[model samples]
Target chain A: MSEPVVATDMRKLAATQLFALIGFTVREARNKWTLLALFTLTTLFLFALATLVSIDVVEGSIASARLFGTIPLEIGNTTIPVSDAVTVIQVAIVSLLTTFGLVLALFVTGNIVPLTLQTGWVDLLASQPLGRTVLIIGRALGAVAVVAVTFAYLFGGSWSVLTWKTGFGNAGFLVAGMIILFTFLCCYSGMVLVGVLTRNSPISIIAGVGTWFMGLILYPLHTYAEWTTAFDPGWKRSLASGIAETLYWVLPKSLELTENATRATKGDALAWTPFLASMPFAIVCIALACWWFSRQDY
Target chain B: MNVIETRDLAKTFGGALGSKVEALRGVDLQVGAGEAFGLLGPNGAGKTTLVKILLGLVGASDGDATLLGHRAGTPISRLEVGYMPERRHYPGFLTAGQVLDLFGKLLGMDATLRRQRIDLVLEEVEMSSWRNQKVGGFSKGMQQRLALAQALLPDPRVLFLDEPTEGIDPLGRVSIRGILRRNLEQGKTLFVNSHMLGEVELLCDRVAILVKGKIRREGPLSSLRAPNPEYRLTIAGSDEDAARAALAAAGQEAESVPAPPGLTVWRLEVGDRSELNNVLDATRSAGLEIEEVQRVRASLEEVFVQTINEADDDKAGAGGPGGVQTSAKGATEVSVATREVDNV
Candidate 1:
């Protein structure tokens, strides 16, 4: 059969495959409610922290310093608020969001990648008329759905605060929130795609975590490579930068998306650039995920 | 025509480094319409793989097969099939009712029928009290019952049961058998994989013995019984030679041995059981005092082992000395359509 026909057939199979998955997902969520509750509480804490920092709780002192002198921090002539500037690159908030993203990824990926060492759900559904492609997509979309809800809740809370205070009534904020959520989902889907491809959960999770760690350690390597042309450090920097850039292209870059969203909402000069740049990575990651998951055995 | 037929259907797993595990090799089988045919094999004899292939769980490596006269694994074919796997797994959090309802819908049952059948199956499996209970808390036996209920929810024309009686109690097994037997009476074809030899011996009209992914023996259960040629006869006579001569005249072979001083044991070979009485009457009429007569029947287990071992011996003669051993479990059984025979 032609590839298109097969693809179409697979899509139809996927559509039919969702019913049982939805039921099973509901079951899994109920069974693991304790863990899910803890994970959600942790997420809520981050949401609370983001809201607190958004309102200038930490940087409020700096704002009060206007009694002494003019505010010194500025990004490209834009009078960035003290709280926004301070919270802009907060690694704590980034880590919190990423952890939540990981939980979402792990939860959905467990369907295909049974987190436990024992047998998984595949054995239950394998005999059914459910197609493998549909199972993977249902799982992927399920994770996306969960992540999207969290993003909406977090952003809606933030928007509520902004609406109450600064009265920023633009719906662009919601779109930006979606892009950020989808970036995580794109990355999560890619991680799950690896799980689907390997059919091993631990290996996929380790690879995902390992890549994330590597990205953190090598983030500055690119800058280091640009500044130096010397032998040892320059070469090391260049190699690190090359690896990081490749990972940057391949992995879902939620940080980049978040940065783009922030820049966009603030109407910064480079607002559209980061979001546009993120598009290629997101598209490629999702396509690769769909392709890899399509070929997965279970 | 058979409800299910396979011609040289084979499946091999693994590659060079991995052992080329032949899950099935040229398994030719046919389950006729309105017949309950048992696929009796031990565990790892490719029964599950065969079922999975029929259900489209795993693609067969080679061969062609048809179920309900349609090529296997097609949606239409699968739609007509009700399957209960050996190891039952449902979403643990779902109540038995919900589990049945979900499977019923998947099988395209209308809402009213789905609800009605779910209730009927729950009670039929004697699980009505636990219908709302989550399957996760069920014992293995209960889980098996629920699985059977789900399989029957579709009211399929063909049923594939893999170790359906594994964890069920004796009474439960009997009830499940009754349910299946009634379905068979209504003209549903059942393909069962189980290790319960006695169950199959009692239930199936015909069975196929599989070893090492190949069917070594296939026929009616009675075919496995040794042909009853040799019968025992006690005669008080000095005219044993006369009796032997008379038996011979009647186209019978009789071997005379001394059972005691006054009586002689005659090992008479006849074509059928009825001819034994005929021979005895012939001997009595010929003025030989007839004493005792009896016939022997072979146990199905003995036949099973002998048939499988002989198949192994044949294979060894052709090649090397290797015999396939599937675990004692996973052998299948079928219930008789109606208590056709009055005697057990």
Candidate 2:
């Protein structure tokens, strides 16, 4: 009887610690709802608004399919030159896409109060019976869930409108949305990695946002400098330059999503090679982020 | 078996330019089951550091400890332990009920059990009315109560409270003491660290006076508090002079100590409590009503002062030990351990 009582007590203790560990994230989400909800809603609203405007343009200019980049392309037996109409729609879509990218960068990199609050919460939680590694992973997953929901609402609302307007229901819209969502996850989760490592909200925000700005501004500088400094380059340097040229694939340029959406909308045969190629770097960054967060002291 | 034990526990901090500051020096403690142990000390005495080590939050420089037969810092040990830290901060966003539940869950309670316990704890803390109120808005006193509630969530077998009543009101302090008493009634061990000697005096079964990271003296309050049987007298007029002359004539040792301007004091040290009344009778019959005569028992405050003074004297003299050695039950074991370590 005594042994059974002790076993029950230990079991109860373990359950309590686990719940407290996970509850840390739930409390954080509720506290910063204003910032999280606003960012999420704003991203969706802009995407939805852009989708509405794009559909209207498509309906208006569906007849002038030649003026837009809706050139004819043959893939096996099917021929679709859905350009002019698609291009008209893609322009507004791409613009919206750019804004989504900016919003993603800002939301992921801005305001670290939530992260600092999270770290303090983790400190309290780590003293319990719960594993430190489990707590860190739980926070990482919680942050990812928040980012996923935000991206879903933004991209889903836009896709719904786009599908409704085109009157051409293609299964590809779902695929394209999934691709964009994955890219956003990669970028935002990387920022969360910064947040997790520093455990300081302000520093996390600065680091995350600073990285975004660097990716945006520095990528162009590197490109221009590559052209100007081509004289000092050898084959290995040229290979390095070539690899760097594909920074959009290796980095979260947001341009890749825009380009993919444009190509998908134009009915151009989309190849999976380039998309798959850019994946290694994204995986590497995500892996590094997880590694750092996992070992981080709660 | 000892509920808690530490062997050769020492913690040294690296100061500026690598100067070594020894915070704790070979502290060996053994607290028995169901004991209310008070760790008394002044500021910078490493009392908190010792508690931190016992809690497994801070590592010792060279020593080891066990809590409930498990290594300190292990889950099994923490399972039976609850701590109310001296410097505490709780997440401000949680409601009083939520705060309780959060800690309850951390102790590994399920939803049904956690809710039930939360309700009970909220009521226990008299915060049931403010159950839905954010802790950020709770007053400092209320926060202290909430901290106590969190510490009590698991109904731990051993409770460690560091200055638990630091920011509490009188009534709040009473409530905390009541809660501790109730827990003690349930046979829980309590290790309390506080500067409030009076509070310790009332609640502690035995106390270890700590100074400069070492246990200066420890024992049951009753033992350390054995009355010194010192009697003081105040006399009027030149009777003080006559009393001194009479004391000399009567072959009784007395000191006519100058106290206030209009009063002088006659002090007589008696060996026992029964001797106090005899001394007073003799003084009165010596043609002196004895303006005021009182036999004072040594308060814990006085004991603390004397213990620290003794430590200081030992430090000053370096080797010539000549002072009262006040140690209670567990202190005997600590002395044995200290000697063992010294021999090794």
lDDT of 2 by residue, B205-289 (tens): 9999877777878788878765455666676555566677655554458877777766667776777645656665665667765
**Residue B180 miss distance in model 2 (angstroms):** 1.8
lDDT of candidate model 2 versus the reference = 0.63
Best by TM-score: 1
Tens digits of per-residue lDDT for model 2, A151-251:
55655555555556555444444455555555555555556566665556666656555544445654564547655375456776676666666654556
RMSD of each: 7.2, 9.2
Reference-based TM-score of each model: 0.77, 0.72
Per-model CA lDDT versus the true structure: 0.62, 0.63
Span of 10 residues, lowest total lDDT, candidate 1 chain B: B335-344
The weakest ten consecutive residues by lDDT in model 2 chain B span B335-344
Which portions of model 2 show Cα errors greater than 4 Å? A1-23, A33-123, A164-199, A211-298, B15-20, B227-295, B310-344
Q: Candidate 1: where is the Cα deviation over 4 Å?
A: A1-16, A38-112, A115-120, A161-172, A211-245, A265-298, B15-18, B108-113, B226-269, B273-278, B291-295, B316-323, B326-344
DockQ of 1: 0.19
At residue B183, give the lDDT of candidate 2.
81
